[model samples]
Target chain A: MNKRKSKNVFINGAISSEFIGQSIAKHQSKTTIGAHNIFLGQVRADEIDGKKVSAIEYTAHEDMASIKFHEIREETFSKFDLTCMHIYHSLGSVKAGEICLFVFVSSPRRKEVFSALEYVVEEIKAKIPVFGKEIFEDESHQWKVNS
Target chain B: MILHIKYFGLLAEVTGCNEETLEFSKNSVSDVLSILFEKYPDLKEKDFQVAQNNEIVSKEMVISEGEIALLPPFSGG
Candidate 1:
């Protein structure tokens, strides 16, 4: 049986650098973890046609997203030798160059975290149901699709 | 049965609402979609998948009284 508790991974807006720093600081007590890998997804300012993207507004089916996150966490834990993992995503408007997604993984050795981090990030990109509306500088918007 | 239908992302913009209810008589996911396509013809042009009770399902899957969501291609990082 899985004893891990489900966590709310959604953040209100862009994730701040301070929050990321604090998260890393909180792991000091866990001396067994020798390696930590972090993945930060930043919003990119892309010019489409004649318009430039200013920000991305994100939304999701909260109930389904939560369930998917939990499943991803469980699957990652079972597949990798990891001490802990964390995932955070923005829900509201996130400006270009700001952090939108953060995934952190820690383990006893270097190799596990390297592979585990990639797996978790890729799984999130493919499995999560979150949507993004790319708002241009002129206020026009378009729906964003994963490539 | 009264089925609660939800539109997400671009689908919501096309449908002009996030959610609504329909008195559905049919049983399959395709039947519900036909009703939606008739009501919002633009939805037919959009690429999306059907989720029955929060799980993505095929058009042939039977659906009863529950929430259904139309989701576009995810862009989450």
Candidate 2:
């Protein structure tokens, strides 16, 4: 509610390092922010019963997901002293070791960003309605259940 | 009444499609599920949550007008 753009957070493919870099660079002008914390989620190639995970395909109820993201943003801003916050998640196939989720939180001090980042990430895991299908190298797939 | 149902993740695979509009006179969430189960038997075996108007609803909640989503366990980061 605090002037956040309430933008769509889904990215089409893997989050490129260049894109991540540009996001960080954009914050340079905000001299009020003295600290920033980031959390990146990478797909892991796990061998399950001899089949290795090749990639993860993500899907979501877009309308509901957007609403949830906006709620999280508002709650975060209200709960912490954050100057700015941004979140992005991949939508399509992202190979193992590729980045699928990115969360960045900035504040005038280090302590707020640290706790705010964890709270935001955990809320997304428990509340957001995004799903992932883990595709094996041989083409078999299984649903990913977060722990 | 007519209801719009949206499916996400494994629920979509179980339902064999992502979204559909079904005509029903259901009074509660469970009644709606019974109809869905008859159409897609696999849906009964999958674990998921039901959301109505962007908020997760319990099975006892009365069916309401607006978009509804069948969400599988969240795997988002």
Candidate 3:
């Protein structure tokens, strides 16, 4: 299949469960998809120096990030038998326990979705130019780096 | 040549501004870094990668008039 056109994947704040549900609902009409997998990244209220994290503020090099995301989508499509895929990441603030990143992948079989989902998530973590500032309850902040 | 520079994440915090433009007589990425380091000495202590025209390039890469971004470690999931 030809690669899909690049679309902006950024959302202004935390992704709502309602939006995720609606996204899944929209895919019900695509009968060729037999399995779907999803990955949701939530902010953690980690304690640092006796201070608890209250939220995470995300920022990105938007032009570069959009290009990287598009490249990942193209590579994933070429490497896997995917029927469709979607990626959404939050900008601005997301409180602890709120979803910040959502990745959904669908395929005609269960196996393809499983591996494809992992690949897409890993690529996003490693390649995208999105940064997160972990904000503590005391208003202090630190930069978060992927492990 | 005038080059547009952008700072991201911790680097932006250190630089105090998200983006700026500077004139450089030299043509390589390292030359730009030296000029930036002179202006923001603290940037030397931070970890980042250089991207030219939206793609990560090494310090040795020659650059022209375009966008240059200093990106710290990515934390997106």
lDDT of 3 by residue, B1-77 (tens): 99999999999889999999889999899999999999999999988999998999999999978899999999996
Candidate 2 overall Cα lDDT vs. reference?
0.92
Candidate 2 TM-score versus the reference: 0.97
What TM-score fits each model? Answer: 0.99, 0.97, 0.98
Error of 1 at A7 (Å): 0.4
Q: Between prediction 2 and prediction 3, which has the larger lDDT?
A: 3
lDDT of 2 by residue, A14-117 (tens): 99999999999999999999999999999999898999999999988788889999999999999999999999999989999999999999999999999999
Off by over 4 Å in 1: none
Candidate 1 TM-score to native: 0.99
Name model 3 segments beyond 4 Å from true.
Answer: A1-3
The DockQ-based CAPRI class assigned to model 2 is: high
